[model samples]
Target chain A: DTAVSQTPKYLVTQMGNDKSIKCEQNLGHDTMYWYKQDSKKFLKIMFSYNNKELIINETVPNRFSPKSPDKAHLNLHINSLELGDSAVYFCASSQAGGGSTQYFGPGTRLTVL
Target chain B: SQQGEEDPQALSIQEGENATMNCSYKTSINNLQWYRQNSGRGLVHLILIRSNEREKHSGRLRVTLDTSKKSSSLLITASRAADTASYFCATVPTSGGYQKVTFGTGTKLQVIP
Candidate 1:
């Protein structure tokens, strides 16, 4: 079984549109994260949540927001998508230990035209 | 910005060969972990080494960490074509509690059969 999963694996939309990507993990992890992979293949962390509490919110733009309804699910919503928002969005999760390894999702490829 | 640095941004090796990728970070870490990602996909956790430990081995993957130097190395033995992927070293900074697991740029490995 897949440990971590993300929906809308492929997303194509026009500029000024709004989109949301959902992520879930069945690994019994208490923390979840959202990372963005640019065209250059650079993976950058955008947000992290622990047990439904927002812990890390990187310098992501206000147009992008992450919401965690529960410890096992975290979703990202992008408002007024722009051309610069075209990239792969990955969701990951890990145990709540001080030091733990994260398991990633299949990734959502967002392309704004 | 990335919290760690990976050397030899890209590597190519033949089957049955050994490949080594190095990572260096700037801050104190609670633990270091390795991840692998296929092209256009999410990352998969490989291994983890605590700050108090120097080395750890799992199957053909051997990881070494030197807290004094703030560097680590991931060695893959008997690599196969399936091992051709981007390897990343993630550092869990000592300042945070499991939410700051930052990833490096990653080293792309192309293993030939």
Candidate 2:
């Protein structure tokens, strides 16, 4: 079974449009995260939620918001998507503890035109 | 900003050869973990080494940690073409309450058959 999964694997949208990506994990993990991989292949963490509680919020713009409906799901919504938002977004999950291993989902490739 | 940076942005090797990747971080970490990501896919957990542990081995994968130097290394012995992927080092900061895991720049490995 796929421990972690993401929907809308490929997204192409116009500038200023809004989009959302969904992620889910069946590992019964308590923490979920959203990461952005730029064209240079630099992966950066944007947000992390533990048991539906916001835990870490990086220096991301307010246009991006993450919502966790439950411990197993975390979704990212991007408002006013710009050309800079053209990158891969990855979702991951892990158990709530130090040194817990994280499982990532197939990334969503976003393209802004 | 990225807390970790990996050396040798890319490596190409023939199958049956050993592949080594090094990572250096700028902070005190509770643990360091290695992950592999195949092209167009999610990241896979490879191994993890705690701050107190010096080295760990799992099958053909060997991980070494040096907290004093804030560095780590991942070695894959007898690497196969199937092992070709992007390797990343993630560090769990020691101060964060929820332990935000930060990823390195990553090393892309291409194993030729």
Candidate 3:
């Protein structure tokens, strides 16, 4: 079974458009995270949710927002997308504790033209 | 500034050879973890070693940690072509919440068969 899954594997939209990526995990994890990987392969954490509560919010632009409706799902929405937003976004989940192993989704390749 | 930095950004090796990647972090950490990302895929957890531990072994993978130097290394023995992927080291800081981890610049390994 796929432990972590993401929808809309690819997304291409014009500048200023809005898009959303969905993530779900069946591992029964309590913490979910959203990460952005640039063309240089530098991965940065954007947001994290624990038990549907916002736990970590990095220095990301306000145009990007993360929402977790339940412990099993976390979604990312970007507004006024720009060319710089063209990158891969990953969703991850892990148990709520220190030194927990994280499972990641397939990732969404978003292209802002 | 990134919390973790990896050296030898890329490496190419023949199949059956061992590959090693090193990571250095700037701060105190509770534990260090290694992850692998295949092309066009998300990250996969490989192994983790706590600050108090010196080394760990799993399958053909071996990991070593040096808290005094604030560095870590990952060694994959007898690498196969399937092992060609990007390797990343993530550190969980000792100061703050545990769910947040700082990822290093990835090392892309090319294993030729």
Q: What is the C-alpha lDDT profile of model 2 across A13-113, one tens digit per residue?
A: 99999999999999999989999999888889899888998988989999999999989999999999999999999999888753599889999999999
* Candidate 2: pairs in clash: none
For residues B1-113, write the lDDT of model 2, one tens digit per residue: 78889988999999999999999999999999999999999889999898999999999999999998999999999999999999999999988667888889999999999
Q: What ordering of candidates by DockQ runs from best to worst?
A: 2, 3, 1
TM-score of 2: 0.97
Give one digit per residue, the lDDT tens place, for model 3 in B43-110.
99999898899999999999999998999999999999999999999998888744469899989999
Which DockQ value does candidate 1 get?
0.65
- Candidate 3 clashing pairs? none
Which lDDT tens digits does candidate 1 get at residues A8-112? 999999999999999999988998989999987888889888899888888999999999988889999999999999999999888874367778899999999
Which lDDT tens digits does candidate 3 get at residues A7-112?
8999999999999999999999999999999999999999989999988888999999999999999999999999999999999999875357889999999999
- Per-candidate Cα lDDT values, in order, are 0.91, 0.92, 0.92
Off by over 4 Å in 2: none
Residue B28, model 3: lDDT of 89
How many clashes does the backbone of model 2 have? 0
